[model samples]
Target: MHKSDYIVKYLANSTSDYVTSAQLGDFLSSSTRTVLRYIREIQAESNEHGFEIISNKGQGYRLIIRDKAAFQNYLSNSLAEHEKSDLNKLECQIARQLLLTDYIKLDDLAQQFNYSRSSISRITSAVASIFEGYNLELESKAHQGFSVQGSEINIRHCINNLIFNSFTMYQTARMLQVDDLDWNSFKKAATDIVKSRGLNFKQELLIQFMKYCYIAVNRIRNKRYVNFEQIKDLEFDIVSDESLTLMLELIQLICPEFEKTTESQWELYYLALAWEQSIYPVEKLHDPNPERIKFFLDIVEKAVENIKNYYGIDFTKDHQFLKDLAEHISICYWKYLLNVESENLYLDEVRSKYPTAYYYSVEIAACINESTKTKIPDDELSLITLHFAAKIERENRKQIKTIILCSTEFGITELLKSRLNKQYGDIDVIGICTCDNKVQLCHDNADFYISADQIEQSELNGKPILQLSPFLDEEDCHLLDEFIARLNTTVPLQSICEPNHFYILNKPAKKAHLLNYLCDYLLQEGRITEKEKADIFAREALVPTAIAPHVAMPHCIIQGSSFLVFAVLPKSIIWDQTRINLIILGCFHEGDNQIKNLLKQLYTVISNKQQVDKIIGCKSYDEFIKVMNDFVGEELC
Candidate 1:
């Protein structure tokens, strides 16, 4: 979200409380100083947007809505733009241009897009990551603009994935606007050929093969072809004579230049590989490559073992789950080899519905990448999460729906909700209800009530309330454990890492040395095995977790209960090409069986850089906990 929009939304949700710069900074995950600057910028134009930010003397700042409709409209538009930005429209436009030709002159693109030369330059850089995964590089030339240089095989695979898989064939064709091709005729001929040849083509990917066949025809006509030398490492049994003959016939439909000759062998292999991949089992004539399957299966098995070692959950016992995971991993590996990607239509749904499974899939992705040196795209990860989601659903645990009854104090209600949600993921905090909405919102919504005061008989509605302080005490917390039906203890940070795991590094240290200290300590205590320690380092090697400004969170899942080992450097340290002042080594012990509460616990602390700075400022354990207690922040009864 835009800085101003986030600040405004946070203040709007804050109710009557006047949020301080400290609180706003924490909410924005920025330093209080940065928040103050943001507040100045927002306030400068606040009146125009129909809201007034009232800065009170002792209390922080409160948003006063002068025009509700206008404010809501502005907020909605800002968030809509934010959500669309991870992959923006203009970036996609430029990517399509790259697919159409070898190079695009920035000067020409600037005139065509009606954007400034600098804007066009910035956009092409943004779209570079899309091709990076396919091992393609965008090289700028003095006069030629920029050229996308890569293997022809990778180029074809990248084009097929982007055009067809990401969008509908109809939408893709319009986006590309390739002038002379007949979409309907091409589709018909391709479908007819597949039907006549009796190839078991995947319905979703059949069109992709056809599109690639079109690329092959165009490229060969331009005197470009896949030479044998480029594919020296290609390994796969040849398709049956019948399949090769069919492949030849399929290519000859449009390009008679393609021939059954020694020179054309590799070109034929290129088309056959694309065709076989489009086929459901890869090849009907040969069993799926046993070595390739085993290679990925080994990595999956090891990752599964790592999960068991770390989270204490065993997927090995569930034969079907392992089998399913292995099969999906094999398919994903196949896509990786071919530089192709598939769309996960249910990615967002899977993330919201089975968040825990989605996180587990993240670990699996990292493990696979470390072993195989390949990135597993989110779409593929979501599919893997479904496999984990199946196991998650089988457990069939009931979630405890909760409603927090508290006053609209500056930070009281927020503190309570964060505590409850982080303590147990299944304990859903439906919403915080005040004296006004308590009777109405609580009646049908809450399974139980967490209140700071006794409920009057008239407002009781026969529901039990756990009367407790805003800062939850041990006895009331124990009662909560029993009330919520969870057997796990509510482990506070003090109990987990306050005294021993916490560190204030006085001397300068490299990122590697620093992490080694944390891992070595865990290893010495036998809290984490040597292999698990190696897993953490291996993960860091594959992907750097550093963010710009001043924050770095190097985290991993582990066996036993979750705990954190935190450290603060006296000065800035260069970590994986970024400088950071604070480091949080989060060892999450998610059982993965129940809803994951630990993730909720860590998210509030690490969600922003300013939050990390605030954490680093605390010199003592008591101050740290006190500051964090408020970070979950606010409520009362």
Candidate 2:
């Protein structure tokens, strides 16, 4: 069934109350725009049938069936399959062919797919950027047809990803049905190794190995072997000759029919490198590439130091965690340097479910990016976050590590620390750091920072500053109590924006026109693309963006830099039966860990009638920024 089938079935079953677009979008995991568009399409098609979707202002949508038999028949026909996407057969065939062939003429693609040249061209454009995240380009030559351009290893990685995204490694092997190859033995070799190993290999890593082996086997059959002569000459060592021999043994056991050529031996070494990167711990010292491990470990140490400086969490003493994290980064960072792109399927779930660890990972990623001058994919970022999340959960500290930045005068800081120690068992006061000795703070392993003296907020980093009198007055004690009470509230990750990115609109316009106009700036800035913009609108159709009266939040998954664009529409245009005066356009890169926190802060502001009114009253970007800072804290844009 098509995506629109979801809306139709949903509306058909809603008999009691009006279903809101937001409700439908949430159920479908879609945007308001997509839901609305689906509803329109479903309704237009249902008009020919016996049912029609009724859309009301306050009440969401309801199904009014004119002919029960006809509507039931229609539902039966559509609901036979579950979550079966209505993909274009022509497009699928063309996409698969394009990935396989080195180059193919547009007309040839059209003939092969049994479609017009224009139709084939359009379909190709859709999947054109499939390899872009892999640091490869799909260049379309005007006369010579389309071909991929990049490092060969990266190309293979991207191709395998594209194939495995739709089909599994074993399934693709079955479908390909290459002649005279014992595919089952190859599969058995992987299963046997995993069985001999342990349960540690159960979590999709086996499938990754299977995928890599299958791709390598298939490519080698076509006489395309990885050229690794120059790669071994490089300083970065990946695996030992023993590991390569083990891989070659497996290969020989599986495909004894193939020739024992020098090229096949090199392929064995290449495959062995994959195994080393997969991280199998040896009984003693197993890392063949100590230089690689040391390099990434140094980077990880730098990241840990930065994390301490920024978030005030010190992991330097955690030698075991440091080693594990560095080894993982060696694999992740090496893949990056090799121009390989991969998907971490666990990224979104980790970001949403494990917010704290994910943020910690983000900080580490920031340090890595700064240290190397590279933008790692969100997928890799997710992998790093996964590691940290696992480590943090394993550590499982009971108390919140906190530090006090109070005056040394009269030892009042000592008094405050004593009081905290006596009253709050959950809050651990590690030490005190004065402004002059604040350099010692990074080593304290304190994430929650508090100040007693009235120091300038600008002097310290953008750490959460709760200023109190050093004298420890009654009001000061009360403030401390309140701050301690709200310690469980998470510090939100916010979108940073320049003052110019914020706009004050003097004239009101329709939502469509306004969204386009606002997103156009992002497009020009290379923050978003036309395809991503379409996704935003589709999301809007699924769920109305307007959160409250005169306020709406429209956002989309963007490329490159993530940003939030704010607009104050003083004229107040009608949206979803209410006039919308405030628009917060959140353009985020996929797998951003901050989206949940950002929405929480934004909804807090929108739900308040007084705050909405105050924002509507603003006449300029400066005024809007001030109001936002007041409502959502100074960090939010």
Candidate 3:
């Protein structure tokens, strides 16, 4: 469950005074707006329950239980009966069955799940696409059933993945159509195996291993054993004594059919490698091949180096990063060789929430793909993106160095500095100067200049100057904040987006019409040539750059001065499957570093739904600027 649901349950069981959103937010370490959103969701959920949330304007919010018995009963049955028949669950079930058994018929699935053959067929079609990611295919024979055709290792990956996903063997077995199993015997065998080897594995992996052993035994009993001869060309070295005895005992106790063949040794080696990577810690691995280990480490270090050079994030010295990536890549390389697809849970969330990092990860994945000559799946790419996102989020709290230039009377500069410090704790005001300060001192290692008096571009030796009022009111503070937003970065978004560049379109139009309209505007303004406009469409054809849900940032590096052209279509226009109301077409030259930064910043802004809401509500360019300013202030601060 999400924290929002936890907060709702807490509120429902509150014993104190009415809880304010502020108190709830503070308790949860979240924003009050987020708390209110959770409360609103809880209120919606209460529509079917016996609990209702009542908000008292001044006092705060109170959870009023209409019927205590009914509310308790609702909570009791919520977990077990919550959405039992979703398409995603059905897909998982079908995939689980395919991974467990050699062949499954549609009629058998239809009878088992109480669904029509057509419905099962549609589900199997989706499952086929998923299997295709692992380089596996669903094949149908003339008089036989359907089977997932793949290498032995890939099939094992699919089976273990299914077991790893569901919490218990009982739940997974139900999905796999395994009935009347001896649970006591399975558990005892797993316990005995772990005890004999003295291996400390997580309870989940213990259950998963038991399930794997059971499935392997059952498949062998049905004369459907996996063929290990296909991978005979590949060499492997086992590095654990525990793995040797464990595999021997498991095969002797469960699948005694192949105890004397090379298949048993291959299965033992691969299973031991899997255990060391997945269940066991990296440090526990006994003397692996040094060259193979260094190869994986080199890939990680080079990827981090490329990320630092490309996006300016120095995760090279981050030891935890090196360890995490090294360990993941070790398993990743094995999966790549075996053509096993990882089932990433946070794929969509990471893609939407941290798209900049996701994009950077794709670039990094491309480098790995070229170097290794292996196709990395999108799920694996998302996992890599998560590490980058975490590193960026960790470094986001660093101070932004600034030099404040104020020409006001005595103590006024100090007061403005204090206010600035309070408003933005992330800003480090290294020096406060008057208008008559030395030019070299103003440029002394500071990122940017914020001055009360208007400074010329040449005054600070090419440093960007943010002109602000002496008193530093809200508008002045926001104006000064634009510099802080891009202080550490190469681009200032306000510099790219001018007041003349914004256009609000209330009329309905297609993407082509909108693009042509913007291109015509640029042509009339002499911002781009006709060929550059055509190049925009050419770039769009290559990849529809809908960076967010309702935002599309389509850009091309053509022969022109950089221009950030924005079109706010509040009524919405169709782009792919998403409804885009904000279109930012960036026209830049062949080499413009700030344009990339501007695109990244725009992605950051549009990733936030609240910021998009504020942007869509804007009726004028000034309000749009304010929204941008507010977003920068909130985010940077």
Candidate 4:
């Protein structure tokens, strides 16, 4: 059954009222025309069930069902049939094979599967499109036949996606008939290996490593091995003899038959790669190579400079911050050289929740990538962001101004204030206003109000009021912490941008030319120095600031003054490597964490494809600003 059939059944069964095509399209992340096409298909499929889609022209669509039980039954049977289809299984198999193997002959595949050459060709063609998204190509040579052409790293990325995404890891392993003992043996060996190396493997990382090892073991057992000689030797540090001994022990421990395996080095290197990506505890900062340490420090040094320049937050003085960030960068560099992939569960959440910290990490990531010439994966990028997020959280702790509104009866107010200071080290208690004289409370610098009495909602005076027990229990502490986080809301993006900062460009230009043009305008307007323009290009070279498909926020840190520059090309202008219709250049001063939330808002506004389309179509600068203001202004902190 088509996906649209399921959607149609859902709509028809759930609603008696008219469901608009736009609503369906939005839910499916599809278009109205596509929804209509699906509706038509559903109508044809629903012939037996007497299902119909009635259109109400301007208002939208309604699902009309006759004999509801019959429709539900048809939907269930069709879905079951779709799931069990041989074609779906074959597609998964072909994709898995393409990802793991070097080359496959169409005729040989046809003969093996007992299918026609034409059928195999069609399957291979369909799988090729999937590989293309990862910058890989399916090419057929005269003698070699069909193979996925890309860098080994990219090929692994494609394979990882195929394995985890196309089917569950357990299911894929089951399909290969991999023994359960092999996985258990792999985990036991992994535990021993990490224990010996003083490294820790979180559950998420362990799962990924196990999957990779399973795939490698299956491939090796089938005589399909990655040739170590063909693999390029990367220059960096290598594991110690003790670690190598542990790896050899790990390989031998997987199975008694593993000792007879011809490709032992490949397996050893796989372990090495895993070890390189594993999280190293701060206590295990033992690098024998001083030069490598210096190399990483130099990268860190530059990153600190860029962060200080761009966001105005100087991390150099934060000793713990420097230590944590340095360790992360070192591992990141090693991972890059060895083509190791790191997984972080918090990547998406960090990107959304801590956009400011994530922004700095992006800057740091770009700098590292520029110097090292390797792309940082999103998970790894988020790991880097975590360090900055921690630092920012520390800074924010000092910035939060709290007020306690407790009466001086039995000296419980003083006791509560001291507990507040002890329980929440981040908050700053500015005043201790009595509950009876709530009107005397300070509202100007206060971020949160804590009271022992039942303060009415109206008495909050727009401030967040946390009602607490006089003794300060666990629940009250939790509530206070939650309220304190709300203090992060700062000045809006529109307030940050002035009339002169907005620009509308008509001429077509490439990314570099346009960047230079924008910088030239900034320089002429005396908003930025020539040196700052060079810094923007330098930052751009490290990472294209295109945060979304249509919007790119290219920015740099400059001395003295900061400017929020917004530009709309309306025409497709090359941004970084992609084409962008809008660019917001954030020229920031030192110690500026305020822009972090603004970037978050900018991303939220840009992520809406419909809103972006409307903004891009604006004819005048005033119209464009109005659209941007309406979108970002109301939501700004």
Per-residue CA lDDT of candidate 1, range 277-335, in tens? 67536344234567556665666777777677655667767766776677667655645
Compute the lDDT for candidate 1.
0.65
How high is each candidate's TM-score?
Answer: 0.49, 0.47, 0.51, 0.50
Return the TM-score for candidate 3, rounded to 2 decimals. 0.51
Residue 409 shift from truth in candidate 4, angstroms: 12
Q: Show where candidate 2 strays beyond 4 Å.
A: 2-86, 129-136, 149-177, 180-211, 221-237, 246-266, 273-295, 306-321, 327-346, 349-380, 386-499, 503-637
Number of the top TM-score candidate: 3
After superposition, candidate 1 runs with Cα above 4 Å error: 1-123, 126-145, 149-192, 197-207, 217-245, 252-299, 328-356, 362-375, 393-597, 603-627, 631-637
- How much lDDT does candidate 3 score? 0.64
lDDT tens digits, residue span 549-578, model 3: 678887655566666877888798666434
lDDT for every model?
Answer: 0.65, 0.64, 0.64, 0.65
Candidate 2 local lDDT, 183-267, one digit each (tens): 6776677667756756245446656666667777666766777665545444565557677767877776655655658766567
- Per-residue lDDT tens digits for candidate 4, residues 1-637, read 5447657765866554777765675454333434554665565456677677666756666676787788778777777767534575576578677665667788888887788999988887656655554546788988777888865555655565556544566786775446654667678767776677666658767776666666666655656554444233334544545655665666566644565345666566655566545545434535545555566666777888877766666787776667567766774564654444353434445665576887778777776666666666545677888888878776765557767776565376678788878776667788787756645663347876777777665346577777788788877765554344334545644566777777788887766677888889888988889898987887665443666556888777677555677777878864433457987788877566666555666666665667788777877767866786565443254
The list of candidate 4 runs beyond 4 A from truth reads 1-129, 132-147, 160-236, 239-291, 331-334, 400-429, 432-594, 600-637
Pairs of residues clashing in candidate 3:
none
